[model samples]
Target: MANGKSLMTGLLVGGVIGGLATILTAPSSGRDLRTQLKQNKQKLESILIQLKDDSISLKESVVKTAQESAVVLKDVTADLQKSIQTWQEEIEPHKAELQKEISQIEEKIKELEQTLNK
Candidate 1:
């Protein structure tokens, strides 16, 4: 974007300098010179108008794209959070069952050790 702005500025400055040089060097009558200058002025104004319109369009497009991206990001984040929550819910029963089994095995091991000692 910066490069684009710099290029546009360079083109505008170059156009103005070129126009001035052409007008100064031309060997035309006073009326013809005035007419040429007027035409050049009109052309420059048209260029400016077109540039302004293009810049506005570019700005609108950038803003729209950014808004869309933000929405998509938010949706993805929400989805990820819901997925995590669902996964945790699914695993909870299995986790508790495994813990109960481990405790039962530990009790049996202790009982066997006590019998062996007796």
Candidate 2:
């Protein structure tokens, strides 16, 4: 997209320069030169209008994309929070069993230490 814009800008600049050089080099009466200059002015104005329209379109597209991304990010965050809540709920039932196993292991370790000391 950026490349297309740059190419369009380069072409417009080249066209303007080429048109101006041709106008300057052409020999003509005052009336004819004024007419050509007027035509060039109209052309430049038309080009400016086109550029403005393109800029507005590009701006709108960017805004739309940003809005969509924001929605997706919001959904993902909600899902992750829900998953965390579910995990905590699932772990709740096993808490007492886990504590009992840890207590048994500690007792075994203490017994082994006392036997070694004796």
Candidate 3:
């Protein structure tokens, strides 16, 4: 954005400076100088109009790209969340099985200790 502004400023300032330099350096009659200035002014106006149109088009393109990126980001986030949930669901049965095995091992240890005491 700053680059665009700088480019526009540079073009405007350069055009003005070039026009002044030409007008000052040229050995033209007063009437001819005035005609030349008018022509230069018209050309500058045309350039500015074209630049304005280009800038508007660039802004619209940026907006569209940003909107599309946001939608894609949203979809990706949702998919990641779903994947995580599915992984957790798949692990739940194994987790329960492990817990049950641990409980059985603890009970056998207690029974062995009791028989040792007898």
Alpha-carbon RMSD of each model = 4.4, 4.5, 4.1
- Count of backbone collisions in candidate 2: 0
Instruction: Report the lDDT tens digits of candidate 2 across residue range 16-114.
Output: 898789787989988998898889889878987898899799889999999999999999999999999999999987987899999999999999999
Candidates in order, TM-scores: namely: 0.65, 0.63, 0.70
Clash list (residue pairs), candidate 2: none
The lDDT of model 3 is: 0.95
Each model's backbone clash number: 0, 0, 0
Q: Judging by TM-score, tell me the better candidate of 1 and 3.
A: 3
- Please report, as a residue range, the 10-residue window in candidate 2 with the lowest summed lDDT: 3-12
Q: How many clashes (backbone atoms < 3 Å, residues ≥3 apart in a chain or on different chains) does model 3 have? A: 0
Tens-digit lDDT track for model 3 on 4-87? Answer: 889989988998899889988999999999999999899999989998999899889999999999999999999999999999
Question: Mind giving the per-residue lDDT tens digits that candidate 1 earns over 19-95?
Answer: 88998899999999999989989998998899889999999999999999999999999999999999999999999
Question: Highest TM-score among the candidates is held by which one?
Answer: 3
Model 3 clashing residue pairs (backbone): none
